[model samples]
Target: MIDITIEKNLKVYQGKQILKINRQFLSGSITKIYGPSGAGKTTFLKIIAGLISPEKGKIVIDDITWLNTDAGINLSPQKRMPGFVFQDYALFPNMTVLQHLEYATGDKDWINRLLLLGKLDTLTDHKPTHLSGGQQQRLAILRALAIKPKLILMDEPFSALDPEMKAELIGGLKVVFKGLGATVLIVSHNPIELEGLVDGELYIAG
Candidate 1:
């Protein structure tokens, strides 16, 4: 399980807001996180990834201590290594579709399998600039999966994809996450889009 309890001060539209959360995230489960725009949903994810430091809290992932303010124990992001699919699709401009996954892992068969899952097998040579928005998003997801991370975090990841693309991609990704027993936490404005796909739900309100 991934356990977290933190209090972070965020400067939102209304001014200083304390985003506090104390929760336990089940391992190998697909969870949907949603809330108001300034409710600090993204900030919560960032805290889990060690991108932002909270005022006080402890984070434990499967018996491992990722964070403990009292003990002065805090793991770096690289050590946590939770696969993240950013809202902006943070892809390397100079890398091709294939190169992105290759950069994460050299397992040829795994790379090929991920390409087919994301329907990018035919565009391995294409760069981020060459692919469409949906394709780029898929590449970001594939790159995250290439490492077989134990935990995956996505921030508004499906915003650019059409209904068909979202459905197809989510369907394929469900299998992959289950296969790897990876825990997934996704932040989406449209929670209804997930419907039956998610195993749990977390709502954060302002």
Candidate 2:
């Protein structure tokens, strides 16, 4: 299980306010962080992913203490075993899809399988700049999976795709997650898009 209890101060409307989160997520389950724009959803995910530090509190995953400000124990991103997919679909413009996946996993067979699952086999030699928005998102997801992370953190992963593409990716992701049995945390403002995707919800207030 993932246990998080953290508090941090943030600037809002020219003043500072405290953002507190106390939540738990079961292993191999999908949890959606739902809220409107300006909500602290992304902030909470970043804290859990160790991309940002909380002022006071602890974050434990599977009984492993990832962060405890009071105890001065904080694990870096590399040590967290998390695959983070940014909202912007961060990818190398010069690298082909195959190169990106190969660099992440160093396994050609696995990369090929991922390409097939994502329906991106024909685009392996294409660069991010040449691919469509949905294709780019798929590549980003494949790269993340190539690392074989225990936890997956996605921020607005499908925001750029069309409805049909979104549905296809969602279906593919469900299969991948089921096979890997990894913990997934997704942040999105659109709850409609999250239907049939997450097992539970975490609503964050800005």
Candidate 3:
């Protein structure tokens, strides 16, 4: 289980805003997060991933403390090691699809399986510049899965995919997530996009 209570100051066009959240995420659950445009959904994920530090917060996962502002303890991103799929896809300009997964894990078998799951097996040699927008997004998802992380944070992961592709990928990801027993939190703008995939929902108001 993951427990979090965080407070951060956000900069908005009008003025400063505080983003505060106190929540718990059950183990192995898939959660869909949605809210207004500047509601700090992505910031919430980033804070949990250790990419952004909150002004004050405490985060504990499975009895392990990841962050405790009162104690002046904050784990580094590498130590936290959650699989993060950035909104931009964040693919390497020079690395091919195969290389991306290889960088994350040495197991060729697992890499091949991820490629197949993402439907990028045939495009293994293609670089980010060569892949289409949807393919790039798939590569980002596959790269995150390559590490077999316990916690996966995805920011607008399915925005570029077509409906058919999104549905198929979601089905495959369900099996993979279950097999790994990974807790996933996805930030999405579209409410209905993840209808059947998410086991829980979180709404953050700006």
Per-structure clash totals for the candidates: 0, 0, 0
lDDT of each: 0.91, 0.86, 0.95
Candidate whose TM-score is highest: 3
Misplaced by over 4 Å in model 1 are none
What is the per-residue lDDT of model 3 for residues 1-206, given as tens digits with 9 covering 90 to 100?
A: 99999999999998999999999999999999999999999999999999999999999988999999999999999999999999988899989999999989999999989999999999999989999999999999999999999999999999999999999999999999999999999999997989888999899997
Residue 81 in candidate 2, Cα distance off native in Å: 2.6
Q: Which one wins by TM-score: 2 or 3?
A: 3
Error of 3 at 189 (Å): 1.2
Q: Residues 1-206, candidate 2: write the lDDT tens digits.
A: 98989997876777787789998889999998887676677778788889888899899998999999988999998899688888788898889999989888877888888998778999989999999888898888888888878889998888878889788889988988888889999988776997998999988776
lDDT of 1 by residue, 105-176 (tens): 999999999999989999999999999999999899999899899999999888888999888888888889
TM-score of 2: 0.94
- Per lDDT, the best of the predicted structures is 3
> Which ranking of candidates, highest TM-score first?
3, 1, 2
Instruction: List pairs with backbone clashes in candidate 2.
Output: none
TM-score of 1: 0.97
What pairs collide in candidate 3?
Answer: none
